[model samples]
Structure formats: C-alpha cells, structure tokens
Target: MISAHLPALQVVIPLLAAPACVVVRQSTLTWLLALLVSWISFAIALTLLVQTFFNGPMSYELGGWAAPLGIEYAVDVVNAFVLVIVSGVSSVVLISAKESIERETHIKRTHLVYTGWLLCLTGLLGITITGDVFNVFVFLEIASLSSYLLVSLGPDRRALTAAFQYLVMGTIGATFILIGVGLLYMMTGTLNMADLAQRIPGVAQTTTVRAGFAFLVLGISLKAAVFPLHYWLPNAYTFAPSAVTAFMAGSATKVSIYLLLRFFFDIFSETFSLRTMRLDLILLILGVIAIFSMSLVAIYQSNVKRMLAYSSVAQVGYMVIGISLATTTGLTAGIVHLFNHALMKCALFLALGCIVFRLNSVDLKDLAGVGRRMPWTMAAFVIGGLSLIGVPATVGFISKWYLVLAALERDWWWLAFMVVASSLLAVIYIWRVVETAYFKTGPVANTEEAPLILLVPTWVLIVANIYFGVSAVDTISFATRAADQLLSTF
Candidate 1:
C-alpha cells in the first residue's frame, strides 16, 4: 500500500520537511532533516524508475478523482529518469552542503537556507511528477521563488542583485507559461497533459494554438537558459553559495530541458512540433549558435564559476541539438546527455566548492599552484573537465558520441563537424583552469586538502562520472526506451 503511494510521497516528503526546517530553527537539526528528506526522495525516485521500467507507465490521481477533473502524477521512463537525477544530485549536494553553507552564509540563517533547499527540491520533484499543465506552472513558481532565496543567501552583496535579476526574468518566463497554458485550456477545455495531447491535434492549425506553442517554447527556453536568453545564469551561479551553485547547476536547467522534451514529443506530438511547425530547424539554429558562442565567451572568463556557468549554456546546446534532430537516436542522445551533464557538472561544481572551501575563492589567479596543494580536489576537477571536453572514458564523451552519431545519421556532416569543433572550445576553457592549477606558481597558503565532509561527496560524483561512462548500457537502454515512448505518441 505504501509502495502504491510512492508517487505522492516523492514530492510530499520534501514539501512537508521544508516548513519543518523553518520550525526547527536550528542549523544542525534542519540540515539533518533536509539530508534525510533528500535521500528518501532519491530512494523513492529509484523505486519509481524501476517500477516504470518493468511495468510501463504509472499514473496516480489525487483524492481518487480520475482523468481531466483532478490532478494526476504520471511516471514514465522519461521523467522517472529525471527524478533520479534531481533527487540523486540533491542528495549528494546536501551531503557536502553543511560545511560550505556555514562558510559562505550567515550561520544564523542556515535553517532558512535549508528550508529553501527543501522547498526548491519539492518544487522540482512536483514539476516532474505532475500531469496537469496548470500544476506545472504552480510548481514552477515554487521552484523559482525558492531558487531566488537560495541564490540570495550568499555572503556577497551582489548575491542580492543576482537574485533580483533572476527574479525579474523568472517571473516573466512564468507569466508566459501561464498565458500559454490558458490558451491551451481555452481551446481544449482541459488542463491535463494527456487530455490536451489528444485534443491539440484537432485544433493544431488554429492561430490560438500556434500562439500557445510559441509562448510555451519561449517561456521554457528562458527557464532552460538557452543562449541569448541566458543572461541571468552566470551571475546567479557565481554569486550563489558554493553548495547552492553545485545543486542548481546540476538539477535546475536539466529539468527545464526535460519539460521541453515533454512538450515537444509527449504533448505536442513530434509530427506537429518538428515537421509542421519546423521546430527542429529553429532549435538546430539556436542550439548551434549556443554551442559556439557560449563556449567562446567562456574562454575569457576569469572566475572559474562564471566560466563553468557559460560552459553550462554551451552544454545545453548539445541537448537542444539532440532534440532538434527529432529521431529516436537523436532523442536518445538528448535524454542521455541530460543525465550525463548533470553528473559531470555537479562534480565539477562540487570540486569547485572544495577549492572555495580551502582558498575562499574560485578565481583562476587564486588557484595558482592549487594542484600541488589540493591534489585530490584539483584531480577531481580535471576528471570532470575531461568529461566536459568529451575525452574518452568519461560521461561527456559518451554524450557527444551519441550527438555526433545522430547528426551523421541525418547525413548532416557539417553539423557533426560543429559538434567536434565546439568540444575543442571546451578543451580551451577547461585547460585554462588546468594550466593555472598545475603549472603556475604562486604564494603558498593552506596546503591542506579539503576536509573529508566535502571531498567524499565530491568524489562520489567523480566516481559516478567514470562508472557510468564506462558502463553506460543501462543508461542508454532507459534513454532509448524513453525516446521510443515519446516518439510513439506521433
């Protein structure tokens, strides 16, 4: 019976624990509560993924109300995989969060910080699990509001500015999403995604439907921080507390990408979105621009966090390109990279958190000779960086390989070439950090490595980067199944 309710519990546990953190008002107690809730969410996510994989799609109606009349939580291979990524990344980030949060934020506000963390997690999980379009908007705001709080918790005054900027942009995006959902409801007379999916095709040619599609795409793209719309991301990541940066860098944008897939393939139907609306061309052009332009921008950044932030925008391009191809292999590539990028980026950011722990900064100049001092931390950074560059035997390489194969599958030799070229740019920026840490000389300071509390969780992600890279069969299988299921809707 409890197992039957796992879908509801996936989100409810964190949702309830957030206010509990506020009530506790003790840093240590709140942190333990957050960590416990995060791990429990991860376990539920894993169980749901297994259940979906073996038993096919699972749906739960709230209060036993069925169909379009009440809210539903739907679990399939696609979002089930994403739930694992979000909760798994959050669990690891929280494991390493205590020390970093204590140093980067006011001690007295730690309970609020964890409260925001849990609320943000709740929002993300809720967004992934819910089947109603309106519920998605509700959960999106919850996540956005909590994210602004987390970003503003940084010690720097500029953190406040970053949060404000994110707030302005996020509110605009959410408004667009709401308008889009309203238009769809006006035409379809339903708010449930499954119901809308069946009804949208009948009205596909209407101007109102087209306007809704445009608004939804624009809104989600902003949330995903797709290039040219990504102005808010770098500063937010740079100014946020290191643990917050690590958690969000891993989870937030990836979830936005999942929504894109859900809409393009699951709700809109690939035939309508990719073929009739020509979304593939639009995405392909934008995705290519994001890859080259953002990677070029990253090369000149002085702050390591900002550089990686720009790099993240570039990586989003890879996933976008995968979706743009609109084939089974292409969708599979996009979905798999969604999972891989989360692992590598989180590891890289967590490693940066370790550097910040010992050095109090992530500036390249400050990291001079850090390799000699913090060997393990820098080594983890190197591995994660190699993965980012798509070096062999790393998760990044696996993603790029699929992307290239997808491009070549369409006889798009030029597109495949661009993918490789963009990766070289990743090499340039990553090597900048590597050369600074290992090769440069600077004044000696604390040569001690980061404490075990931090190093252990950071390495956990690093190990996953390698383990999944070498043994990617299961991930690829799930991604393939997810892709097949999405494409089946056509």
Candidate 2:
C-alpha cells in the first residue's frame, strides 16, 4: 500500500539519508548507506516512470493536502525520466566513488564527503520532482552548495579557487532564479508550477512575465554552463576529486537543462516561448556557435579533463539545438541526447578517473604508453571516445541521427552539415588520445591498469551506452512521449 506513492519515496529516501550519512561516523558505512539510498531511489524512480507511463501521470500532494495549498510531487514521464537519469547516474557513479574518495579525501573528512554527496543527490532529485517554482530554487541551491564543497575536495590548492569561483557563480544563478520566482509570486500570488502555467498567460503581455522568463533563462543557462557562460566549468571539472568530477559531469548541468525545459515549455506557454519571443532563434544560434567554438578550443587544450570539460559545453550545444527546434521530433532528440550524453560523459570521465588513479595527472603527453599497462581502462576510454566522435553504431550516433532528423524537419540542412563537421572535430581531439595511448611510447611504460572497482563502473556505463544505441526502443518511446507532453502544453 505504501508502494503507491513511489514518486514521493523516490526523493524522500535520498533527502533523509544525507544527514544520516554524516551521523554514521564510519566512511564505509556512510558509503554503503548512501549507495543503498541511491539504489532505492533509482528503483523508485524507475517504478514512477513506469506507473506514469501506464497510468497517464501521477501527482502526490504532501501530507494529503491539495495542490496550491501544499507541496506537490509530480511524476509525469518527463520528470520521471529526469528522476531516472539523476538517480541512475548517481548510483553508477557511487559504485566508482569508494576508492576514489578514499584516495582523495582526508580521513577525518570522509563522512562529510558522504553527507555532501547525499545532499547533492537529494537536490538533484528534488529539482526534478518539485512542482513549485520556488522549491526548485531551494533545491537548486542545495545541490549547488553541495557541489561547491565537492569541487573543493581535490588534492590541489587550486580546488579552493575553483570552488570559490563556482560558489560565486552558483550563488548568482540561484539569486536570479529566486528573484524570478519572487516576481512570479508577487504577480500571480501562487508558486505551484501548474498554477503558474495557467496564471502566467494572462500576464504574458506584462513586463513582469517577460522579466521573469529572461531571468529564469539566463540563470539556468549559467547553471547549465552554456557557452559564453561556462567559464566556471573547465576549472571545476579539472580540480574536483575524481568521484566528484564523475558525479557532477554526469548529473548536475543536465539537471539544470531539465529545469530550463520545464520553464520554457511547461511553465511559460509556447506562444510566449516561440512566437512572442526570439528564444528559438537565440538558442539555435548560440548552440551552433558553441558547438564550433568549443570543438576548436578542445583541440588546443593540454589538460585532458579541461579538454573534456570544453567538449561538454559543445555537447550541450547539441541538446540546445534540439530544444530550439521546438518541434516534437527535435524535443525527442534533445531529451534522448540528454540521457545518452550522461552515460557517455560518465564513461569518459571514469576513464579519466582511471588515468588519475594511475598517473595522478591528465596531461595528454603524460599518458603516452600507459595504455599497454592499462589496456582495459584505455579500451573503455577509446570506446567512450568513439561514442563521442559519433562513430556509426555507437550511442552518440543514435543521438546525432535523431538530431539530424530534427534539423531536417525544419529544413535546416546546414545544421546537419554543422553536426557532421563538429563530429569531425571530435574525431580529431579523441584520436589524439587514441594515437597517444596505442601508438606512442611513453615515460610510464610499466604502470598498472586501474583497479577492478573503477573499471567495473566505467564499463557498466560504457556497455550501457552501446546497448542503448543498439536497442533504443525503450528510450525512444519514453523520449517521444515526453516530447508529446511538453508540446501538448500548447
């Protein structure tokens, strides 16, 4: 009977587990507890996804109170999909975090690490499920605050600087969201997203709605690290602990993008988002420019993590392009890419984690012949890299294939050409590592491969990447349905 409310359980389990992790006092216990909570969250999220799929949609009112009067937890296919992404990614990354955290974090601070991780998980889940716009900002801050701490957990002193930069940027972003929410509340006297959705249209012509939309878009864009606003990403990714890097890479920004979608499509009417505004054009142009510019920047980077960081910005461009198209097909492409890219980034960043474990640095030249010693790890890297390059039959190929279809739906053949061109640049950057690892002789010729623990989680995501690319029915169906829901908002 309690199982009926899996939507609320999905988030409540993680939110309540975080502080308990700190209270546990043992690192392994904390990690184990956190892992159990994460898996439980994933299971519940999956259940919610299925329930919503079969039953149309479900919303749980907190304490049995009705909407607009109490906290509402909504679990449509879209939020359910996001729930799965956040929980699933966090679960997989947690499997790889045990040893990485042990090696990188101070002995006395391990409990803090576990606690912060749990809080971040809670934040991500909360953002996805909350129906209140103000609660979204609250949970976003929870996640952002945890993230700043995680980024500072790196062994380098620069981690402190990176964390500070992230703190400033994240605070500003959160402030923008809060102010926007405040404006919405001031104008409409309600904070429930659905209520806002209905009320906002009446004020669509007012300066307040426009101001709220602008602030929300800009704030979420910065949080998502869209190009020109992504300055905090490279350093944060480079300086964070391996586990921290993997977790944030897989989940954080993607969640922010989900928020952006919920606002532009669901909260604000399509009439305001499309015809009354230049959002589609702006997103399209920014996405294309980011794709080309970041790809170019990646080729010149000496630091591998920073290189991949820039690559993430470019990959975000693909998703933004999908959103800008605003077509059903384009949205499907965008949401599917969000899921696929999370796995791809997890695999790639896990590979970098392995390199860091062995050599303690991600400098491209330093990686020379270690591939011979770390064949499995390097092989995983190559597979993920190939996926990044959009090699046919890989998961990336599936994403771009749909993206191309989306572009053609709008008769934007130049976008198709640009997609191919960007993939070519990906080939160059990814091949640089392939050439270094497989073909060149290096200084560290006898290093051992990564531990099985790390390799297991790394391969889990990599293999899933291939599996999904080949068998995309479930993903396609969910994304398609999600697209329909978003577009049906009109």
Candidate 3:
C-alpha cells in the first residue's frame, strides 16, 4: 500500500506544505516545515527509483480511473532518475536557505518566500511524475509563476526586471506547450501520455501532428535554456537569492530536458518520423554552437554568479549533444550528465552562496583573496570547478567520458573533439575565478568563513562529486536503465 501511494505522495506532500507555510505565518516555523517536506520528498524519490528498478514501471491511476479516462502518475526508469535529482537538490538547497533567505528577503515576507519555494518544488515534482500531457503544462505554469516570485524577491532592483522578463517568456513557453497538447488531444482524444503514444502512430502523417511536435520541441527547448532561447536564464539566476539560484539552476531546466526526452523518445518514437524532421542534425549543430559560444560568454562575465549561469547553458548543450546522437549510448550519456551536472552546479553555486553570505558580494574582484579567508568555502569551489572542467576522478569526467564514447560510437570524432575543447573553456573560466580568489590580493584583510550550517551542505555536494566519480557504477547503472527504457519505446 505504501509503495502504491509513492507516486501521489511525492507531489502532494510538497503541494500541501505550500499552503501550510502561508497559514502558519511564522517565518522560522515555515522554513522548518518546508525543509522537512523537501527531505521527505527526497526519501520518497529514492524509494520510487528503487521500486521502479526492481519491479519495472509503476503506474498509479488517480481516483481508480484507468487508461485514457483519468490522470496517472507513472514512475519508470526515465522519470524516476529525474525525480531523485529534483528532490535531492531541493533538500540540499533548503538546508542552506534559512540564512540566505533572511539576508536576501524582508522578514515581513519570509513566510511568503517559503510559500513560493514549496509551490515551486511541488510543481517541479508534479511535472516529473505526472503521466498526463495536459497536466505537464499545468504544472509547468505553477513552477514558472512561483519562479517569478522567487526571482523578484532578490535584493537588487533588477530582480523585478529579471522576474518580469522571465514571466513574459515563461508565459509564451507555457502557451506553446498547451497548444501542442491541445493539438495532440484533437488528434488522439486522450490526455494521457501512454494513450497518446499509442494513438500518435495512426496520425503520424498528419500535418497537425508534425506541427504539434515542432511547437512542443521549441517550447521545451526554451524552458531548458537551450541556446538562443536562453536569454532569460542569466539575468534570473544572477539576480535571484543565492539559495533560489542554487535550487532553480540545479533542477529547473533539467526538468524541461526530461520533458523533451519523454515526448521525443517516448511519444514521437511511436510516430518514427522525428528523425526525418532532421531534429537530430539541428540539435547537434545548435548544441556545438551553444557549447562554444556560451563558454566564451561565461569567460567574459565580471560577476561570478552570471558566469556560472552562462556555464549552465553551455552544460545544457552537452546534454543536447547526447540527445542529438539518437543512440542508446548517447541518451545514456545525456541522462548521466543530467544527474552529474546537477551535483556540480549545486556545489559551485552553494559555495558562491557561502562567499556571498560572508563577503556580501559575488563580483570577481570581491572574491580576490577569499580563498585565504574562507579556505573551506574556496576549496569547495575549487573542487567543484575541477568537476566542472571534467577533470579526471570527478563526476564531470564520467559524464564527458560517456559523451565522447557516444560520439565515437556514431563515428563523429569531430563532435568528440568538440566535447574536449569546450571543457577546456571551462578550465579557463574556472581558472579566472581561481586566480582572483587565491592568487590575487584584496586591499582589505578579512578572516571570516561561512557558518558550519552552510559549509556542511556545500561540502557534502563537493564530496559527492568525488565519491560518485570514483565509484560511478550506481549512477551509470541508473542512467543506462533510463536510456534503455526510453529507447525501448521505439
């Protein structure tokens, strides 16, 4: 009975906690409630991942309704891995949020901040676990709306502007997704993803189906911050509170990427014409461009947070490259990097959060000599940076090794070379921060480090980067299963 309810409880726990936080109206109590909810969700995700692995995919129909008639929460290898990533990152970020929230948001609105945080968490989990196509759009908007509120709560005046821009873009993305879902419903007369997968093959030749696929891919790509459409991400991440940035940056776009994988490999694979649409080629070209161009942009950023934001886009390119390869190996690489990148980015951003907490700045110049003052925090940054560069014996290296192997499997040596060269760009940008932090000297003498409360979570992720890298069998196994599940749908 408990196993059967895991799907519903995964989203419901956080969904209910959002309203509870508002009604309680006590800032510290609300934060504690949110943290408890996030950790519970994380545990539930682990159980679901293990359950799916041993028992095959599990589907829980809402209200005892079955098939095309009612909504379902399906947990397969594909989304089970993503559920772990989203809930796991949320737990880590919430653990560090209390101090960051007090510093960035007004005490009067702290309860409101917790409300939005839990709502955002609920929406993200709902998107990952839901089996209805229309429900995906509904949850997407929920997350997007709360995301705007979170960004707007940042200390800077530009937070308002950033939030507004994200709102406009997020609305457009959500609308396009709804339109695509509507078109599919028109053709199939079903809202459930499984039913649509079965119905789509019959309508594969219809222009409406092709158009819907096009719209969905473009819309999801925008949300995933896949190059050209990524204009909203840098500003939003840079201006949002550090904890908010860590949570969203680590999990949000990855959910979009999961949506893309679900629709294309699961739904469109039934149609078998996505390849004829030349999507693979398009993604490969765009992915290569994104990898190089965004890394270049990151190299020039004066603000450290914005720099990492651009790096996020570049990292997304690596995922796209894996998807574009259209092989099981390629998909496995993408899925593996999806989880690994979340770890590295969270560690890096949380380390920056520690810097911001102590120094009150994330400017490259302000970080000068920080390594001496905050050795543990800066050391975490260095270790995270090494992982970002795909250095040997770090989680990043494992992802890149798989990516290169996938490229070679496709006989695309050039793409393999691109992966290595782009990693070199990460080296340069990370070195820029290292030079400023350890080598360069600040005028003021400072000797304060972040409190243990923040340092513990930050270092935990850093250690994971190494621990998982050295013993990557478990992560690789899960990713391989997810890839196989997606590919088997073909």
Give per-residue CA lDDT, model 1, range 134-210, as digits (tens). 99999999999999999998768999999999999989998999999999988999999999999999999999998
Each model's C-alpha lDDT? 0.93, 0.89, 0.91
Best by lDDT: 1
TM-score of each: 0.99, 0.98, 0.98
lDDT of 3 by residue, 8-97 (tens): 999999999999998999989999999999999999999999999999999998888995788999899889999999999999988889
Task: Name the runs in model 3 displaced over 4 angstroms.
Answer: 270-273
What TM-score does candidate 1 get on C-alpha atoms? 0.99
lDDT by residue for model 2 over 150-215, one digit each (tens)?
A: 999887889899999999998988898888888888889899989999898888888987887888
Q: What local lDDT does model 2 show for residue 141? A: 89
**Model 1 spans with C-alpha error above 4 angstroms:** none
**Candidate 2 ranges beyond 4 A from true positions:** none
Considering lDDT, where higher is better, how would the candidates rank from best to worst?
A: 1, 3, 2
Error of 2 at 115 (Å): 0.8
- Summed over model 3, clashes come to 0
